[model samples]
Target: MVLRVNGLFGWVRANDRRSIALFGGLILAINVGAALFLLLPLLAVDPDHAPVTAWGGYARRYVPLVTLAAGAVFALHLMRHVRSVQRLTGFAFVDDADEPRLCRLVEPLAIGMGLPAPYVGVIEARALNAFACGLGRRDAVVVVTRGLIDALDDEELAAVLAHELAHIVNGDIRLLAAADAGLRLVGWLARPPAARRQQVGALLSLPVIMAVLPPLFVFILIAGICGQAAIRGSRLIRLMISSSREFIADACAVEATQNPAALVSALRRIDGRSRLNHLPPGQDAMMIDGASEGGFATHPTIARRIAVIVAVTGSMALNAPKRRDTRSPDQRDRAACAIRTGVFGAAPPASERGTPDLVDPGDARNWLGFTPVMTLGAVLAVAVFLGMHRHDLHRPAALAAALDPRPAGILLAVVGREFVCNAAFSSVGLALRATGLDRPVGCDAAPARDLAAAQTSGSVGRFLAALTEPPAGLSMHPNGTFGSAPSPATEAETVRTRRCFRTKGYARGDGGLHAVDAPPRRDGAFDIGRWLAGAEAQAVQTAAAGPEAGDRPLDDYLSSRKSIVHAVDRYFGEPGLAMMRRSFASPSHQRAIGRLRERLGDPRWAAGLPPVRRAEFTLLANSPEDFVTCSARDRMDRKATVPPT
Candidate 1:
């Protein structure tokens, strides 16, 4: 236990140092840009200012001094707030049974090291992913995805879980969260809104400030660009930090479990199965897949990871386990039942519910590097283009005289530049919604059309879609035309009609357009409105309430929750059961069957019929668990596949 704790603590220290070093260069660069923002203002300030003359032109200047101070404060405030946000996001945990296993592992390790047990939670996702979150050891939570649980056997699962614990112990979670927060802060600062209002206010106070302000603004803009560049440089460093942490975690996990073979085999199988296509950026390092290059992604390559595990242990079992032949039964009834269900025709007994010794995380790996740089590069490229246009706006009169049709090049340039910046901002906005941080203003479903397009297509896709599509129709009433997907004209009308109140924010009388001043609603109210209504919520609640019947055991609950796809592919895939065949006629039909099939995995023992079906097969429940009551009307069949009344 002491050893585990020390190991984790040492890991955190090492990880932090590496991360700090990686991001150090970027921070310095950002400071340099920020420093310019401060220094230029001093130069702009009057030479006669007291500070200028006080020290014989040494330390007396004020504007630059003040600006520098202000910039620092701004940066610091942003850093602090963003850190909190990142930490909070990391702290979110899923409440489930797997959490106990994590606690068990961490507890022993913590006891060995004289540390407290860390909080553990499950993420309700199919993706094989996991991450540790907290500002520090005492504050952290380790979250693993359900897909990971379903994928890895025991030893492998333990390895991945241990790796995350190592991150918490080493302090990698806090460090990375801090770094991400800083980057996000800097990006937010560089946005036009943060500065635009200030610039306008400054102009209002002293119109002459505008005269030299453009140059000043230009300088600040360059500084902002440099700041972003620094951030990118910092991210590169953090990647290396993450890699080293992975190495240490692997070593620590082996030491803790004393089962290097499990870790090695886990890595081997996980390496082959991982995918990189759906990895969410910024959080890639936290995933078991570690990008795609094996571990070199966020950790290192699987080869490197495996080699380390092997070196730490001794020669592992080289022979692969014999593959089990597909089951063949003479009776058509058994085969048909298997086909009608999923891969797992029946739930494994409770004792066999989980692998006791697996050591891998999962197969989905992230090989691609962190992309903050790419995003920054794109933003800078657009800003530079826009700045050039601003220069054009200055010479619009000259260009007008040169060309017959007054050169709207300046107009085009300004619009184009602003468009890029706005698009980027909008993309960020959409991501916020997806992450459940905030909702878009004045949108019924938050119009997330741009967000949807981005997710389905790509960032560029989102930009193009937004560019081609007109502003969404505004609705004065909650259930107005804009509530549903409608014609372009209706969309246009909604936008036009609601344009007046769009400025008012989300109020009852007007459409629930969000107030800019308010933080995004956390209840996911906007999306909830779009998806679940009174009837929908009631229905879901009723179903989720569990078998209207009676008491159910743990095994029944676990099995019932398993995906029907697993059972259907296992049972119905065979050429026997007519009912199962009719159910799984199409992939879409198969998916529908899978959803319903999940409930059947549970054994409603309280109803007390026969033990064979209860022990060997799962029974459908009204909700998560029920022994007696079930919705006779198949909800999936009635609503999903069949027409509604």
Candidate 2:
């Protein structure tokens, strides 16, 4: 019962067939009405005075152009959308030989879903989430983060794979794109036309704000933001529909994998840990819904997703086996307990203090193969980057390439190479770095991936807090969210303080220290973004002078020399390491390095890690907050990723 392309396409087309029949009937009705109106006038007046055929000529001439325009747009959507989105958001194919484990797990799930195995891509992020993209089942690609592979147990991973496959089978990829475009059109209709830019200089200046983007790019940016806000009374309803699709996808995952508990566990593990939300506009609609919201949210809370899963499976325990199993309770429990070490290579719970997951040097998913396959992929990506840069030069050529399926697929494969982070690959940068490819003149101030600025912060305060206290061009929300909400005249307004941060002890091997961000014991109220950003930004630069001098965090106060090096480290790792050793690179971090030195002293430090790496570790430690307790505001949030021990 494998899902053949023919069968899948037929079913999808059958289920999603548009109202072309109805449109044809409506067209006949409209013509009939027009003829009756014209003929009735002729009946009242002289036949020669009537203008019955006046409108027919104009309709005949113009209708073809309208149809042609609609066809052209549909062709563009089918041809360009898949690859453009893959490139726009960083995503690369997962090499089966290199990442055998992920490939191994996904194939069975694909079979379970009755579809041809899907192409898998890695997002090269430390965030524990995944999203699917395709024009159809044949072209489908499921993109998982490096974090998702690292954290989830085998069954949980399978559940996720099944969910992504479900999206493909249901034609959700094209449907989502179509729905989003329709919504945008609705928004456009709801608002007046955009005002034209006043001057050429004003138009040219936009790219500077968006990391040296072109004028056309700025237009796309403005449209994405403005369109979402313009929709009227039905806006909330659309969001509800979006949210419902997620539930359906979840159900599909469960039905495919028969492991609702694993999906629940997987959802819990994600918990909005990565700072992907901050990465530019136009991508939010496509990525996983990890942002905070109220009524108009696209995805429900993790709790709600889990509750649905539990209700369907009728299994209350996270570790329980399938509900239909006739096995005795003890045997089922025993099977659950064995989850610590399975195909996914998980370890027992921390309370049990089991041995760590074995790390194989040859494991393709890890950094061991970086010198060969990983480096090769990086080289190919750079070439594709160059090609895409070249491709952007001629509009018609680019459009032609997009319209041609083979060329577009090749472009996506090459573009997708930039996806993995520097960890597993030769490169070390994470997913949030914008390509900034094909930017116009006056390009400068490129965002560095090593800094984690774009990838980590969730709340606006959290994102801003990562920058200098007065973060450049960022807005702060009095409420925990961005937009405002109205209150009744007699209602008592809620008073609140800004949520900030304090520090926890250094977490060794993580290359950073921990912050005790939570308030009431796992109340799930702690904001990861504020904890990381605000707490770090709060740190006084002990090495600086004057009142404002020593206040910047280690990240903001980097010497001009290291700033370029940090920027370079966005793609290259070892050079940043070399730059760190030049001199007091990170004074704030030195304190931690000093702590490590004292703790590991000379003999053990030498034995544990090479002398050369000591400096790199100190420099990799980003940001430093002066431990302070300010007036509490509702804190920002992001990831809850606990690194593998």
Candidate 3:
């Protein structure tokens, strides 16, 4: 008979440490393999050549470049993941009002572990569960279900936060993310799909194969079969191996917080509640399941996790001293202050407030039916185009080769690019959605007005119509006029309330360009404030920037705009800021800027900047020879222009 509790508190700590060490060693091995795979090709090209003079030299020259590109892509993927997590977590009914109190409890524990305060979020589900997600500490998000919040008191909550912090500290997320991306690339590269029929003519050419001969045929066929099998096997193995990381994380959490009972209690509650709130499957490891052990389990069983935690801490609880607020004297004053400020007053009526649509048009459920058809249409369209314009098929192989830039790499690269790019575009569609409901019945785009009059159509029909038809008067040009500017009365009221930043309007024309008006602004010197302030200002604009900004009440506009702008700014700020910054940079800065200039294509801005020159320079001391080779310090004086790619 096994002593379950004893096993829980015993052996887990040691096992977890060992697992972590193993993981680090495995990662090192992976890096070594990557290095070798990259180097072997160059070696095979010309072994007789000097190692430095040969492919090794080229590899060395481009390793940094490759690393930078890969790193940037990974960073972008992680950022996207965080945003997705935030949105899904925010949507759940968890009350954020208690976040400060929750933070207060978790902060001490975080400090005890030398970690930054973990972001705490609440979901409005009755599941006693929590998960920590982010690529790293600075970007992490902690989401706790409503049930978890309701079930666990302060101490337990701290314990849960500590456990998640352990995951962060161990860099579990980073490791898992790397593993996932690597496997995906490997899978993509291994099972390269064939191009369409027209594009496959070259592969079918008898003479082309005759030139390459039986060796090429034998190699390609064998590699294709074996490579696909290996990739599939690797994926399954990766999934299996990854589950152990969860157990290791549980142990790490115990070490970080030095509390076992709290975690155990939280687990008991979560298990009992049995309320399921699944995040995207890709993010399952970040959830509370420590050892998703079964069908879709990404972690081990709770019992095993508890055992691990118990083994490490040995029944000791590392409880920190709680803050005691003994401010009896200030109670009456606080009550009086609240009354004076009207903070305790009755809630405002619904009509007085702004309301966002109950549904979002681009939500996965709303788009689910249409997306498949749209995607199939896109694929079929590409196939049809390739078939009809068979002459154009000549480029696919060359294009594939260029994209992959390696022999036989084209097939894999093209397939991956198509899938990834399409997914990215789908995400973009989701990001741009404004409303969920369909246009009202009889609400067709009136040709002259470009506006659809609201009627009583079902939400789905209106949504479809909105996508299929352009509004009547809306010009798809980005620079199209936004009618007249707001009147003085509207401007004064908006400015007084400081809601100008988001009140601008935009209409898309047939060309798919959005013609937007000048967005409202604060009295600040710069365009937009920091993210939070910008969000507030934008919401104010969205509420007020409707049919008659010139006539709408500033109060009503402020209320309405607040909700819309908050989401818009949260999602769109970085790109928006880059756009705005490009619009107003000094001439010298503009000259130095490479990609920014090309993207903005503002002729005036480009013309204003001084021309950059490329020069070869040599350094010499006083009375020294003019042709002396420059040392690193001498080269510092020279400014080399980076050519825009």
* lDDT per residue (tens digit) for residues 1-645 in model 3: 244334432434554565466444433333333333343243333222212235465456645655575566556656566555555444332223655556676667667777777666666544456777778877666676655554465656667777777667767667665645544444333332321123334234322332222223323334344444444343344444455655555565666655556666766656534334333333355567532543334565676656655555564633334423322344435434543553321222334222322111111111111133333433454444344435635767532322221222222222333344445546664553444322322222231122122211322223323433434643321111122554333333433333132233432122232212335446532233343354344434533354555323333322332333333233343344244334324343223232222322655543443221001100101111121112211322343444446
How far residue 314's Cα lies from its native spot in candidate 2, in Å, is 2.1
Candidates in order, TM-scores: namely 0.39, 0.36, 0.37
**Model 3 spans > 4 angstroms off:** 1-69, 87-101, 194-259, 272-282, 294-297, 310-645
Quick one: best TM-score, which candidate? 1
Please state the error at residue 454 of candidate 3 in Å.
69
Q: 111, model 1: CA deviation in Å?
A: 3.0
- Compose the digit string of candidate 1's lDDT tens values, residues 1-645: 123324333645665565666666545544443443334333323222322123344234444654476456545644453234333222234333535544555567655544467766654333455667666667666666544555555566676777777676666666665555445444443332223344334224222222212232333345545544554554465567767778777776666665666666667655634432223344466555566442224556778666655544446424334322222243234434433542221222334233222112121211211133333433454454345345455676532332221112222222333344445557788786676553234233322332333221222233434444445663322211233344434433433332210111121213333322244357754332222133233333333444653334333333332323223222222221222333334344333234445545443533353332332223332222221111212222346686666
Q: Is candidate 2 or candidate 3 better by lDDT?
A: 2
TM-score of 1: 0.39
CA lDDT, every model vs. true structure: 0.43, 0.43, 0.43
RMSD (Å) per prediction = 34.0, 35.0, 30.4
Measured with C-alpha atoms, the lDDT of residue 172 in candidate 1 is 68
Error of 3 at 382 (Å): 28
Going through the candidates in order, what is the number of backbone clashes in each?
66, 16, 35
Worst 10 residues of 2 by lDDT: 488-497
